[model samples]
Target: MKESEFIKKNSVFWRKLKKELKRSGPLTCRDTFPDDYEKVCYQIGLSRQRGYNLELIDSLDSLALRMRQELYRKPSLSLHNLLYQFLVETPRVIRGNFSYVLAALFLFTLPAIATYFILLKQPHLAFVLIDPANIEHIEDMYRDNAPHLGAPADVDSRVMMFGYYIKNNIGIDFSCFAGGILVGIGSIFFLVFNGFFLGTIFGHLENQGLGYNLSLFVVSHAPMELMALVFSGAAGMKMGFSFLIPGPYTRLHSLRKSSLIGVKFLILAAIMTFVAAAIEAYWSSLPHLDMQSRVIFSLSNVLLIGAYVGLLGWKRGPI
Candidate 1:
């Protein structure tokens, strides 16, 4: 019960506990954690009761706290865990915020539909929405005899395109998400602008009799690309809405709370964009698949994506 006697009795155990805590790599303390932790808890109580030196008591308290943290800490990341997070947690988050997704879809689609109709009626409007040079370039690319329409021909070219797509897509996603801090006007603007511009291009292509070629080139990746962009816009809007209507929390707290959810959506959007780019660079460009085959493949992609997003994480509960 004397302070000196207590210290002598517990010093060896404390040293061993510290050594175990400092071990590199995976914690090998799991098997003995319960006993060691309980023992430390008891030691701390005894040290206090015996009027031990303040330094000794403080060290015991710190050790006990560290043990508790180590015992309850989250598991380290692994391949399987990462896959589960992507395949499971990501979709769950999306589904939970399906309203935002729907809003994003509408925001992007309505403008596109309107612009498509307008451009279809008057093809010259395409020049207004898109640069004249870019319009010409698109027209040339889809021309019947054009050589490099779908994907680049060489391996290096494909890789370069892939990298380009990743950068471009990520940039767009970041802009859309960051725009939320502006109270969502930026997100809305970018989404509508992009949708209208794209629709104009499609309408112009159709008027020029290149619709089939353009569809063939874009159909394979359109679902993924379009959905990803929508999700990005949705995330931004969600954050913006949080700011506008923070409920009980202060504006700053609401923004922070919404950001947690928004970041997940952004991450999912990036993944989808990466996937779209891969397909665009490789599968979408296969030269051999006719227009019908390409359309079928594209439809299949839509169905697959729908199924994955709708059902992959169902009934699994939260991550």
Candidate 2:
């Protein structure tokens, strides 16, 4: 097309793009800026190739420069924004996808409940679900008036257990998140298996008359750890669902779309697991605290977590 014709055809788009770049605040969708910048570059090239007047060419060059600056500008990082993303945006994402969260909860808890009751009826089932040596070790750890509930009596052992908890918890979280690639079968399997394992352990402790001790050990961090795992499973399920039902887009496109949300879930789950690990290491392992104190502290932590997630981003305007 002739220079004049080309200019007339795209002048409106160029003007709008420039307006967006010059706006006083950050663009709502920074993702579009690259495309706008590329279009401006193309327009500038065309203007120069078509032998447009010096004035028109210079104007296009100036516009292209502004586009480049805006496109390459580094975003300012602020503590407030970081906190808002962690405390608000993360929970908002979870709330928005509550259906998936509910599904994950059901999948994780149902097997636990069933296994708990089944083991209660048949104590020997614990031998089948968990290794006999491990069961014996766990039973000894929580035996009546055991010096330590779950961790060893020395500081080194406590530190080692802390590291182990972090590694184990995060490993489980990653496994649940990565399992989505298998059309969600892996996620389902891990969730169910974990639930059954936990239930078996719980039932075994109860059968051995160590339920109270086990409860005291786990109560503080169980809420965070269990919920984090559920979130991870939920993320995997979301990715798998995208493949199973691509909706209006191709399967690849749908998976890409779902990944944006799945990643947020994974991040939130990681944060929760870290918190749980810290609590388990420092507070839950303290042998000095009485059972009542531990129970109260655990309940308080659960309540605060619930409030933070339920109310932080409720009905707030768009991010």
Candidate 3:
């Protein structure tokens, strides 16, 4: 076509393009223009070869406007996909027997509760259970050539009392947390055994007249330690449940997901255990602590446990 004749023929088209550009400030050509500035120049070169002065509008702002419009357009979201992912994927994560871990940890408390009965009958056991370093003086009633209770206070037994607490508490917490894979059976067994042992030991101490002193030492820190164990149990149950009822995903996939949750719980448990150990070592064992002080520490422990349980419920209705 002749240049003048083609220009005349496309005059109306050019007018419409100019009008759109004036209204939308260069975004109008978003459909036709290339997003990249260099690419837009390339297209303009082609348009000029076809006898159009598209170069007259070559600028960064024009190119950027076109690019933004092209990049911003997206398909609308609908309820179908949202519902499918929520209904199908979310349940597999939420529904399961996480309670078993808590139940198991609760069982561990039994030993602590029952120790009194043993301590009353077998006064010797109090000395046996009393940490060797904490025992005040040597006496004959202890069968292992060990010091009996009611002996003079040693006042200066230099050992890593705190270190022992940390090591034992951390180890037990990890064991309980990881053991949930037995579907809480292992954790529960461990908790019950520990609880009964601890209870009996304390009971023994109370029978021996050292109970108040020991209470001043333990009540401050045992709360965090016990709560940490319960959290660990929850972590383990999380893993076991994932294995038992892996809904849509293969067992392996479910295990991987559950394992992650387990790890998170285990890590939190470990941190709490460490905190408890620090408190037990430094704050709880102060010499000559009074009754009011002991009561305050004991009450604080209850609050901590209650707060942890509350946390479990706060996130979602208990797993």
lDDT of each: 0.85, 0.84, 0.60
Model 1 scores what on Cα lDDT? Answer: 0.85
lDDT of 2 by residue, 39-146 (tens): 878877877787887888888788888777766667676887777777778888888888888988899999999998999999998998899999999888888667
Find the candidate with the highest lDDT and give its number.
Answer: 1
lDDT of 3 by residue, 1-319 (tens): 5545655664564455445545644352466543343454454555567755544334323644555564465534567654433333233332343465556455665566667676677777766776654544411233222231233324343136567877898898888767767755676666766776667556765665656656655677777787778767666766777777889988779878877766655666677788887776566555456658777876877876555444333244322
Report how far residue 116 has shifted in candidate 2, in Å. Answer: 0.9
Ranking by lDDT: 1, 2, 3
Name the regions of candidate 1 deviating beyond 4 angstroms: 1-9, 34-69, 78-89, 121-125, 150-152, 207-209, 248-260, 316-319
Ranking by TM-score: 1, 2, 3
For residue 245, what is the lDDT in candidate 3? 82
lDDT of 1 by residue, 242-261 (tens): 99999999999999988888
Superior by TM-score: candidate 1 or candidate 3: 1
What would the TM-score be for candidate 3 when compared with the true structure? 0.53
Per-residue error (Å), model 1, residue 36: 4.0
**Each candidate: RMSD to true structure?**
3.9, 7.2, 13.9
